[model samples]
Target: MRLLALEASQNSTYYISRYQQVEEFGADLCVLNGEGTEGTWPEDRYRIVGSKHIDDIIAAARAWHAQQPFDGVLTFSEASVTAVAAVAEALGLPTIGFEAARTSRNKLLMRQAHEKGGAAHPDYRFVPELEDALRAGEEWGYPLVLKPTLGAASNFVFRIDSPDEMRERFPQAVDGIKDMAWFTMEADGLDLGPHGLIVESFLDGREFLIEALAWDDEVYLGSIVDRVTVEGDTFDDDVHHAPTSLTPDEVAAVHDVVRTGAWAQGVRRSALHAEVRFHQGRPYLLEIAVRPGGGGLDHMARVSAGYSPIEAVMNVARGVRPEVDHYTPTGVHTAAMCLISRAGRIQEITVPEEVSGSSQLFFFKVTAGPGDVIKRPPHGNNILGFLGATGTSFEDAMSTATELAAQIRVEFTD
Candidate 1:
């Protein structure tokens, strides 16, 4: 059966390529998110139909649906989740509904549903202006997180330590910074349903990721990744370890939370990625990106834990149950860490092995070059490259990955 994958992620690059490497599935890019992509994909196995508008994406999906009767649709993106759901529903396909997708996009709605569903979470308020957020903050307290109610990649998220900071950031609230599509800005700028930015009581503690693939009305969790991020980089969850740092009880606890969260949000069988933070022993929701975590997260799961997220995703898209073996770790540990390139031109690499080395050693997937727009303290899609490796332990896995990251030797040639 033909599968239409609605992915706008650069993360899917590795997954698509790995699928081709393993000769798994024949897939096509049903739509291009106009996200400009994190990087380019390989030239074979799939076709690209680039269109950023929802009507165009819907049109494309409909055309494909008439030709081959696509079995189902899959997505790893929030920007297009609603669109995909609508398309799939019209085609009489099985996937999460537009209602669930809409609820997932709004932080206010998510919190309310979680609360109504008896899921544990912090208090949050949504407001149209900075004043309401501040008012919510006054009620919540200092050290509250001010972020977009319907945002990904942490575009306008911040923390306020005092009333001064709140006033300083919000000041007067302006919209449309780059003429980046009125619809796009509207979606990012306004929370029509919840009606504004969210002021959530900050729940600080160790955060972990729970990625699951739902099929046959059952949810199968991949890995529980231990997450860390760059000092100010809130977009990407920087550091990741497979097999999770949680004990058995904690894992089970998180599983219940995830299942409840999905059910509460109206998410049916589909691939779901949830970002959760734990305080003292309770799991508090941070933010949920409808897609898989970027930065080669699926790749790291395979390299570190022997699981193929791409295959599982394909199963859901094709209405087939994935053939997944229970993972058994070898003595060797593995990891794939991201490498940030300083703003400069591509001059040379200190380690030549990256250009000509076996997979057992290390791997580099470089995306930036000199003369490119460089920013200090990388976050969000501004990443320069990736570093991956296998070692003997978790610490060793991280260390080796970092060492490989250092060897990446990128000189931004400007």
Candidate 2:
């Protein structure tokens, strides 16, 4: 089948990784972006690859449509929601609605919808000014999370437990975000995405995930994945167990929450990666990113759970019924651990031979070699790229990966 994929994250690595996944599954893929092309990506993989501007995606889509009559259109999280919807709408093809995309992209709107639907979420308020957040902080309590309404990889998400902390660090946050509404404003209309920010409680407890596949405005089924993080919050190092570590009851509860969230929002034509934390033994909605999750969440589902998120997403765009992984859970833990660097340029990257040689190590791949600068932002910075094994237990895989990662030395330009 042919898949028209949107790859305009403005982050090269994310697009490349996702593009690779789509191409691997025997689907013909096409690329559209906000900014123009990056390096050279083979046309064999992306048969219709180009740096088409936001307005130009349609023409490109039409050309492809006329030539090939694309079977489907696939896109990630919420960023490409509008473009995909517009493209699908233009083509008289099925797509996630503009309103639903808005609900998913903006955290304030998403949480408010949950509350309206009689679901539980942290107390939150969205305001254009910083002072209002401070006022809300007073009304609520300490230990709050302030973040962009539209973002991924937990970018600029901070947890403040005290007024003193807020006073000490609140002002620096007022820079370089262009949020209005997800669909109404584009870079040309008004920078509509992550410019808007919100503050909510730091919902404390163990975090888990539910991956849902939607068919004809219904979340047909879902899978449970457990989150394992080195740092307490996501901004720090984080990992995932493709299969969760929760009990059956817990998985059921989590999956129910996912269903509830999707049903409540009327999600159609997408994959949902939601974060749920237990509050008083019940699932409290952390945040729902209505797209396939980043950081091998897709791969985990493929390798550990026996499904491809990329292929499933393609099916959604094709208007075909999709299959989602079920609650018949797999391992105690099947981990996808990432080894990160604090900061520095890539002088050299060396993986331990023992770890690389192990049979358990399914895929060990690296991005950087020597003389590449490693930036602070972990999302786009490809210092030491990795794709390694799947172990019997999450803890074992994590510990082994961590131990081996220490030996990988990337000498910075510093």
Query: Can you write out model 1's per-residue Cα lDDT over 24-113, one digit (the tens) per residue?
Result: 545544433323353354443244446445555566667767866777776655556666676677678876676777787777888888
1-414 per-residue lDDT for model 2 (tens digits): 777776443444445767776778677776655554445366543433243344566766776688777777767735666567667777777777767776776777788778887666788888577787788788988778877777655555677777776664455444424321222223233234445668887766778766667665456335667666645323543566657667878776776676677656667557777788887788888766667766666666666666566677777777876766465544534555566676666666666677678666544556555776554432232335654456667668766666666666655667
Please state the error at residue 101 of candidate 2 in Å.
1.6
Stretches > 4 Å off in candidate 2? 44-53, 176-194, 217-221, 230-234, 352-358, 362-388
Clashing residue pairs in candidate 2 are: 143-161, 178-195, 179-195, 179-196, 345-412, 347-411, 362-389, 363-387, 367-385
* All candidates: TM-score: 0.81, 0.86
**Model 1: ten consecutive residues of lowest lDDT:** 173-182
- Candidate 2 structure lDDT: 0.63
User: Among these predicted structures, which one has the highest TM-score?
Assistant: 2
